[model samples]
Target: MTQQDRRRIAAGLADGLSYAEIARRLDRPTSTISREIGRNGGPSGYRPQQAHQATAQRARRGTPAPPRAAVPAEGTREAEGAREESAREAEVIEMAVRAGLPRMTARVHLDLLLSEEGRRTAAELARRLKVSPASVSVAVNYLVDQGYVRRERDPRRRRDIYVVDDDAWYHSIMIGSRQTLEAARSSIEAAQAAGLDRPVGRRMARAGAFLERVSLDMMESADRWRSLLA
Candidate 1:
């Protein structure tokens, strides 16, 4: 849909129109409206500008369309959307890899993130991603060690579910910041042993001070957000 369409949908929501009503007004399907709102933060939190920007970012990074012969007939918007979504998952994997995630780990993490449930068993993930269970196991183990995923048990099914969420973000940030701060401090100490008055020592000291301040600020922000969420 066009940006104008999204704006109209937002306006319609503001006016208290239901998803079905909005779809009727726009001659689209209710699922389209519902999916749009859900992805953009649901009806209560939906913001047209943010949604538009997110949509644009996804579009810019979208995967190339498959060959004509491989595609279904025209007018199958839902099917087409599903195919595009699977293609988009590849882009997510690529972006993760560029960000230093291992290839298999990236795929597994992206799969979990893109999943509707936001959680999956190793076997389920491996099946869905077309990889071996052993591969998924190794990837998830690495992800857990890196603070990217959490392991949980399904009481009803007796299977482990790997989850990724705000906790992962908070933990990863705190861990990385602490490590950086420690390394910077060590550099400063090493430089000081030589001579604090020297240019190299001054540079190291300054770098350490900057990183220390940044780490403190990040930790403070993370704590504030945690309390707010709590």
Candidate 2:
């Protein structure tokens, strides 16, 4: 359920509304509302407003309930950091997919990027992604070809590690802009060649012009940053 929906349910409960009433208003099952309150708040002393406030605070802090460890460690900071980093990377992968990236591709890329060692061998990546070594190799090669990642030979391990640099997004945007500009230019040319004076052609021409301008602007900006770095 959505945060808004949760909040409304909490508010209704705080106002002493029965689960049936909340379910009716929210158009959800009464059991669902009851379970939400029971899970999020306490069973004996459930307060909707307090529950909502606590949820909000947890969100603001970017904190989730601690997961039960398969085997509890002796309070090691390193293990804690690793867990936190893994969780953060998982969120990043989710966001990337939501932003239109393929889930497996995003997971592979994010795992490589967020590793504390800064790179991962094909075998390690395959294990982490639950895929075959060949799959990991292909994904790494694709990322490398797209300039999103690089490969370095690990002399000691005799394995190649995929390295995603900090400026990956900048390169990704540049690649996308070039492709968009090319497609927009082709559309504009096709519209002009057809010699159609329809509204659709005019709209396509306008869109292409805008895209061209935007692409040029982005290229200039990227060049400026390159110069600055140099």
The most accurate candidate by lDDT is: 1
C-alpha TM-scores of all predictions: 0.60, 0.58
RMSD of each: 14.0, 12.5
- Model 2, CA-based lDDT: 0.68
- Model 2 worst lDDT window (10 residues): 65-74
* lDDT value, candidate 1, whole model: 0.75
What TM-score should be assigned to candidate 1? 0.60
Write one digit per residue (lDDT tens) for candidate 2, span 10-34.
Answer: 6775564556667789998554565
- Deviation from native of the Cα of residue 186 in model 1, angstroms: 1.8
Steric clash count of candidate 2: 0
Top model number, TM-score: 1
